[model samples]
Every structure is written in C-alpha cells, then in structure tokens.
Target: MKETVPLSVTESSEAEALFHFETGAPEAVRAALGLNATRIGDVVAVSMRNDPTRYWSKALGFGRTAAVTGELIAEVCAFYRAEGTPLAVLQLVASVLPEDWAEIRAREGITAGSSWVKLVAEVDEVVARAGAPDRRPMDGLRVAPVEPGDAGRWASVMMRAFGMPEEHYSGMAAATVTQPDWYPQAAWLGEELVGSATVYRFGETAQLFGAAVLPEARNRGGQTGLLVARARTAGELGCRLLVSETGAETDGGHNSSLHNMLRLGFRVAYERQNWVWQPAG
Candidate 1:
C-alpha cells in the first residue's frame, strides 16, 4: 500500500516571517534596491528600488505587527521620504490584526491597497498535479531555466505582460534574476518569448514569484507551464513546500491567476492587508 503524506502547518506567523525574510534578504535587498537601503527598527523599512509604482516598495511587517507603534510609523515614513519614495506602504496580515486595523492605518496617512492572498501547498502535491491528464495542453510552448544573456528578453516580455513601463519593467526583471537567491524560468513559443517566472528559495520553502504571461499568449498554457516548471525545479532543488501570493478575491479584478493557483492544489494560507501611503502633494 502507498503511504499518505501529511500536510505541513501553515501558520500565519510563519508566513509573515517568510515574507520578511524574502524582502530583507541580503541578496534581494542588494539586487532590487541597492546597498544600504534598509532602515531597521520595530519593522524593516525598505527603500524603493525599481518598483516606483509602490507595488513592491513597502515596509515589511509594519504597523500591523505586534509592538509596532505610532513612533515606529514616523520613523519608517522618515526613512522612505529620505530615500525620495513618493509613497510608502505597510503590509498587514489580516489574520493577525484587530478588525479595526484599517482605521488605525488611516489615522497615519495609510490607506488600503489591493487585498493580498497567501497560498501554500505541499511540493509533492504540486508536482503530482503537473502531469495530470485534465490539465491544459501546451502543444508548442517551451519553458526553460534562463541564462544571464536572456535578461533583456525576459524583461521585455515581462514589460508587455505586466503592463509596466519599459524602463521600470526592464530594471526590475533584470536585477531580480541576477539575485543569488532567485532562479528564473522563461517560456517561449518558437522564436518569441511568451512568459517569465522566478522562484526565490530560502531554507525549506521557495516562493513562486514574478510569474507573468505575455498578453498575446493568454489562455494558451504558458503560465501553467511556468508553474509546473517551477514546481519541478523547486522539488529538484530539495524544497519541501511552495508558497505564493496574489490579489485577493475581493480586490475586484478577474483574478485569473488566483484561479490557476487553485487548480495547482494551492490553498489560501491567509490574507493580508496592503496599506498605501501617499505623501501630501
């Protein structure tokens, strides 16, 4: 008889820690933002890097966390302002805070951004689902681990896929793949690059991040191919679990990516609040 594998606990605190570790890692901090960009305090205040749009430039575990005070918010805002970031963000795990946390954030010039959902599943579960017969067939798509020479192409594809401006998109994609902790994958159809994704490995878990599919390639299995490729790659690298985050169902978008994640056997580990801070103009 075959043995059944046990599911690992997905504690909200652990997920929060994972988020911080990824954002504060030496390789990530250096590559995305640059040297000497973090201001450590009750929460880690990070300087904006290539993500000028305020999507990825935020203080990890900010006011939403325990022991974070108004004083700390002031300090964090000061650091971001010093770095010349036009806006600041505080990421709060919904499962970790009081119901009125949004009001607290509002009192400090912080407002809610997109609601984010964190999902996790066993590596084996993900790997097993990769070859399911019911899965969409990618007749001509090819996904492969990327080489340094492919940075520009990857960035270009991501720019078109994510609707990011050329300069910011290129800078983010190129710098991210160069990080020691990141492994990038590229999907192609014939001579054209169609998708991109990266797995950021740390300890026993790897976060599947930066996955994007070119507009022209939607509904053609490019993204699913990338997910399967990442799952296999993570397993080969000895990672025991896979974790990822996307916009929450309440965020008011179609959320096709979140649906795809569910099809891969990932479950919502928790939800988090994304708080945005716009400086008075």
Candidate 2:
C-alpha cells in the first residue's frame, strides 16, 4: 500500500471553489435553476434563486488569496441581495478570519451559525478501512458511476431522497452529471434506484460533494455502498485523499452522516463555524 500524503487547506479550498464554479458552464440547468457561481477574488459566492429552500446560497473559501476586508464582505452580501437570496452562509476556515471580522460582520447583518465538520481520508486509509476498492453488487444493491441516460433518474432519486420535490433541483442535480470533471454515483436495488452520490476530481483530491439514500433504503447500508463506490473510483484514479463535510454534532443533535463518514475512515480535518447573513428590509 502506498503511504498517505499531506493535503493542504489551500488545495482543498481551491478544489471546492472550482466545484462550486462548475455550474456556470452548464447552460442547460443554469437557466433552469437560476444558479450563479461568482468569484470575488479567491472567494466563491454561489446562489440559486429558484430554490425555495435557500440552502444553496453561500460564500466560501474566502481570505486565501487576500485578507477578507470589510469591502469584500460587503461585495459578497450585495451579490446575494441582488440574487434575491434570503440567506447566505459566509464560510471560511477559522484560521484565516481577519482581526476585524466582528466589526465587518456587525456592519453587514452577519450572524453566527452552527459549524460544519470537514473530513478527510487518505486513499490508503480508505482502502484498508472500507475494504479493497470494489463496486460489485453487494447484498441486494449494486453501485456504479452514473451513465448518461441515467442522469435524470439519478437526479430524481437525489432530489426525492433529500425531500426536495421541486423540479428545478432535479434539473440542477442532473446537470452535474454532464460535467466532465464530476463523477456521480448511484446505487441500485436490483432494477430500482435507491441512492445517489457525487464526487468531483481536481488534481490529486476527490471531493465527495453530496450523497443521500431514499427513505425506503435507510438502514440498508446504502450510504456505505456509496462510500465504497467513491473510494474505489478514487483509488483507481490515484487520488491521494477524499474530502467531505457534514453538519457537526451539536447541542445533542446527532448527525448520522457524520457517523457514517467516521466509520468509513474519514477524520475531522477541522470544525468551521458558519456565518449567516440575513439582509434587512
């Protein structure tokens, strides 16, 4: 087994920004979702005006290229305001917060929010902990990279699994499969699709962007299967590490997703508190 290597925060942030920016080139779903991924210097500010949930609007990976000045924060807020986003989660690693963030945040209507636990697993660690890279059918489920014709079905399962019935979300999810840099995976219970997951490749790292299982498939190991499928692909492609994040276990609120990732060998790289902005009328 090859020894694990280092994964710098800079590379991980850059890769995440690229993944967020990926939606811009896919015009088909871009118009359908009213999605925009804007970059103010190194910061990536993304928004989806068509989704009522408003969870899609956030600015992340800021302050790497330069200090996050008050003006830069204002620019991000203005972008969200113009996009009609109800809220924006402004996220960055805690290590990079400027000394004057409190002043800037107070002036911009920003409020503190819960944190997300970023996780990382070396390829060798995954191989050892999750078993050898294998995507063959296990139990009653089979996992594989999404096929072109199956993108719509993948989107359907993804949106439904996430409890989102909005048609545009399916459109947004499906459009990601068409991107050359993204690797979307799906698990099938015989002929029926039960789960979906996606990984984005940027250089030596693979970002596990999203994954979910149908309610009916819960407790059936579908989540583990998705992890296995992604690990197998990342292994074959020489990816040094797999990166992902889930809502932190907070205030007695247990997160099953975090448990799944830890059980599969991913370790917490850091806990980053999210800053939320709600523009005042």
- The TM-scores of all predictions, comma-separated, are 0.80, 0.89
lDDT tens digits, residues 165-261, model 2? 6476776678778776678899888899889998877677878866898887777778888887788788888887888878898787888888878
lDDT per residue, candidate 1, 1-281, as tens digits? 22322122333223333344345444644465532245455355555544555554666644333555566666776677666677766765554445555565666677777778878877889889988888778868899988888988897787678777665446556766676667789999898888988887766777787789887777788888888889898898898888887888763558888888889988886677777876656
Q: Each prediction's Cα RMSD?
A: 5.0, 3.3
Alpha carbon deviation, residue 243, candidate 2 (Å): 0.4
- Candidate 2 runs further than 4 Å off: 1-28, 132-139
Cα RMSD (Å) between model 1 and the true structure? 5.0
Report residue 214 deviation for candidate 2 (angstroms): 0.3
Candidate 1, pairs of clashing residues: none
Worst lDDT run of 10 residues, candidate 2, spans: 2-11
Please name the candidate that would achieve the greatest TM-score relative to the true structure: 2
Model 1: per-residue Cα lDDT at residue 37:
44
Local lDDT at 249 for model 1: 77
